[model samples]
Target: MRPAILAILIGLLAAVAPVAGGATQRASVSVVADLIERAAPGDEIRVPPGVYEGNLVISKPIVLDGNGAAVFDGLGKATVIEVIADGVTIRGCTIRGSGEDVTGEPSAIRVTAANATIDSNTIEDALFGIDLQEAPNAVIRNNTITSKDLDAGRRGDGIRLWWSHGCTVEGNTIRGSRDMVFWYSEDLRITRNTVADSRYGLHFMYSHNTVLEGNDLYDNSVGIYLMYSNGITLRGNRMRNNRGASGYGIGLKDCDDITITGNALLANRVGVYLDNSPSSIGSTGLFESNMIAFNEVGLLATPNTHDNVFTRNAFIENEQPAATHGRGRLVSNTFARDGAGNYWSDYAGFDLDGDGFGDVAYEPRSLFGAMLANEPNLRLFVHSPAQQAIEFTARALPELRPEPTLVDSSPLALPPTIELAIVDSGIGGARMGVLAVALLSAAFGLVAAMGSDRRLTAQHTGGGA
Candidate 1:
């Protein structure tokens, strides 16, 4: 009897397959495209509440408003929407079901024209969320994007700008995607964005004069990576728990004229990693007033990385506050600027003159750190007995002490206040609220236990009565 039932169900599913396939084919007709053709170039087309299946192309200036209740389904085909005209606005739509093939670089929306606005859209199950190619002065804001259900390495970028200069990307949340990348783009203003569960929250290459401010990035391979970019300003961003393979809160390579200030780099493998930055001769980098805290290595720089000034930053409770990438020391980098230096939690120096600066210079000369620099594998034994023994031996014997990696002549006597406001994506708030509730419950339980004990004592010794 069970075999007969299974056979009947299989036959029914087989019979429905062709009918379902025909429905999908019929839904592939571009309904929005017909509406676009009928409307004038400058007219506003407000799509009503429904699922409009098929791909769309906007080739003239117009406002395509979905009224917050419309969805544009791609039928698992190529890009869902393509904008080829300047001054186009696409907002308040749900875009999903793009083709999963990475070879075609399928995106929910691909804009190739200048001054387009893509805002307040939810893009899901897309291989690539939004791609702006040579689309200068574009605005991308308040969008939530999640990629296809592929492995992290196979997923395409959440948002990508290729040669799209003078763009503004703000208030977007991206998750489970490859990267939010900018390539060969200049004068970009990226702010207030939250990106997590991605490869790189922000990746920039050859993009100059960009400002990345007030963004929150966590649980990514790397928070932000800038390569071959110049005149980039990174300020007031919170990068936390980015502990992937190359887990740097901020990684810089061959970049020049970079300013990193007032940011919090917390709980990453390396808070900041630098490789030959200030690559151009006579160009300098500045890192100031930032919080580098609770990482395996607070700052890790290659031996040849030079001309970077670190000042007014706070390095707090890292396993290794600073370390070289390889065998050499970080003597080329400046730890102090204009008689002011950063705050190190491990600094033993004191300020006798009440000047808020340490009297002695702060130098990190750890033999274990030097060994870890030469052989990064040695970090496996970090915080173990072996590491303690090595550090103790170096401290006991002056000759065994390695040269200081970097010196701060005027180390701060106290940690400076760093002001940063990151937009939380509610996960942090929920976790914190749970912790508060747990704490309160524990306290209440303890109080009840104590009261019960008091009552029992009163029955036995009359003290509580």
Candidate 2:
């Protein structure tokens, strides 16, 4: 008779389970620290599904519902699920091994208090997967944090928000994990995160009024490393590639009021690396309409990084669309603001007032790009023939022009259609027939010295703001 109705429903769930001091609220994996030391204070601790191991210190307001097949294993020795108190959550568990002991800083889910949540968990082979010390109004959402521990110097940050504040780190996916940091946090709201590989896929120090939108930083080594921050707002992010040894699609050091707009900075290696960063003043910082393509130096600003605002940005096919560090000055920074500028795929300049901007002032920088911005190994003789005879002696000796580091004045004979996504950058369809016959014999000797000095009376027409 159906085995006596399955032994009368397993003797009515062992006669109402609850035992407290004796521990038994229907959870398993060997009593899970005696059912969270006899859970109470807003208890819900379901956690059934399997492998529980050790180190679980939940203080109180519990929830820990591992409905997604639990597996909390702290074997690397501690911090598998710390959670001090205040409204804890730790949902859909699978949190794994932590404890690399960088000062006992092990973690899989630490959360030291405040409105905690840490949802959709899957945190893998960790060192520090979701550690939000000094935890404030937390919400580390849609977590997946990983780190098959490939020695990223010593894995310890897939999500670390020390001295945390009003947090909301959303839709996480972080890989490898050396940093997803936001030290000393404040009004945070990081969105749609996806950070990849390791070493900094978002590392803001002294975190300030943040608002990073639609994040997707990839192949990390530096895909967003703002230091000494200020009211930041990097919009519609997508920093990609991120090659190393100083790779960057966002490295602002002494940051202040940053506001990079409509971003895409692809195949990064120095797309937006400012030293003293957009230190705000009047207009309050800006790097509008970005897509500084195929980097090798698209906007390596440094010369005092004065009052920021590099308007309508889109210096495509960058082998150097402007650079500066030392002796590479004169970017008195302000590449056209209202009359509009910025869109230099090596602007040829000739907008005789047809108004899509490009009426002269286009100097886009290059004494061999100021020696690859002060000796970046002169890039293996860029286009040899002695670098096209030093670019035809800096365009027929305009006093060997190499000063105006970024004065676009209205430059853009094409390239700023703005709604940025550009990253094909075949880099001028490749060529090297001896540097294409030394740039076609330096463009027929610069067209026979501009046809004996007539110089074609200014006339550009590729308009398309």
Candidate 3:
């Protein structure tokens, strides 16, 4: 009886199946949406190497595999793939946008499930390359994300995480996005990514216990921004060329217990800008074993920031040197060519002994630096001949220089664990010197203009006639 029933059901299916143009089989589905609609949990959908134009929604726990370099084009309206189920894998595809949207968040791919992997894809032209919301234990790795619009207020990010935890974001190249990594989520590992031409390379707000390592953050308005975050480790990163009028390589505000080590900060308007407002009380941050070089100012610590340590770090050739805003301690750090001194290109202290370290203490903080702190425009006089003469005199006379806290008579030892001197030697120092010269030239131009105006007025008056 059961065999007869199965045979009757098969006969009914065959009779109902539609055929076209003398064919017996039904027409195969052409759109990816149709394929996804037909997919079941634990099934696999193999996409061919062609442009599939539509929004794809994966509601079942299935694998979507691109067989041969497939491309998913989102026709400039909606997300390419929106995953709403756990244990989904989307791999080996090129996903392109659905252009920018002012009213909503558009993404090339969005994963809102657990144990999902989005990998080895090229995503572009979306408001966000990948948006991970409320997804835990997800891996978004080895993707290239690019966007054309990088305007300050309009452009979107490469990867945006909201309320997601235990995610690993690794080995991605994110370019032309406003904020490459926007982390409101926590417990993330962001490693070995190259983020450039963005507004803020890595932005962490209200996120904690995140690790960012071995990343190259360059050409952004601000390389890394940490706000109200804690227990974050930023290690072995290179932040350079982040030069806008108000840009910083790294900006920390109201953050605590953050460790920054083994990073190179080069040619930024401000290498690290720390603001401790009244709201930020008892914030303890540590900056250790980083090469802060060739910046307009090595470290700008504002008022209300307290109990932070600048230890064992190299501050080299900064035009205005270090500016202290609030009370902070600088301990056992190298400031000059001598032992424990930074490799300041402006160091004039003599090495009286045969030892490599200078005999006299090299005071990195200067009255000129303090003056420039009050009047930042006076930074134009940083490398002026007159300024050089003053610095020389200050170095020759101990009282002339900023009073030394103490001198390290012994030879300076490089930090054993941290490779702070990773940058090419000539490039960093030369860049700082060039900036100093340019600033001086501007100052001289202003002086000449004032003098010319005064002489013209005197000539017109003709001795009070």
> Which candidate comes out best when scored by TM-score?
1
Candidate order (lDDT): 1, 2, 3
lDDT value for candidate 1?
0.92
RMSD of 2: 20.0
TM-score of each predicted structure versus truth = 0.87, 0.37, 0.74
The best-first sequence of candidates by TM-score reads 1, 3, 2
Candidates 1 and 3, the one with greater TM-score: 1
Better of 1 and 2 by TM-score: 1
Which 10-residue window in model 2 sums to the lowest lDDT?
456-465
lDDT of each: 0.92, 0.78, 0.73
lDDT (tens digit, per residue) of candidate 2 on 50-119: 6667778788887878787778787777677888888888888887887777788788888788989888
- Candidate 3 structure quality by residue, lDDT tens digits, 1-465: 999999999787766643322223323224666777788888888875566677778888888887536778777876778999999998888888665675667788988889889888888887778888898889988888887464755777788888888899888889888786545678899888888888888888889899989888888888888888888889998889898655788888888788887888889989988776213455557676788888987877674455665555666777755666533323332233223433444555676764555566545656566555467687677667877777667767877656433233332333224563234435558888999999999999888877687777887899679
Q: RMSD (Cα, Å) of candidate 3?
A: 13.9
Q: What value of lDDT does candidate 3 attain over all alpha carbons?
A: 0.73
Query: Positional deviation of 306 in candidate 1, in angstroms?
Result: 0.6
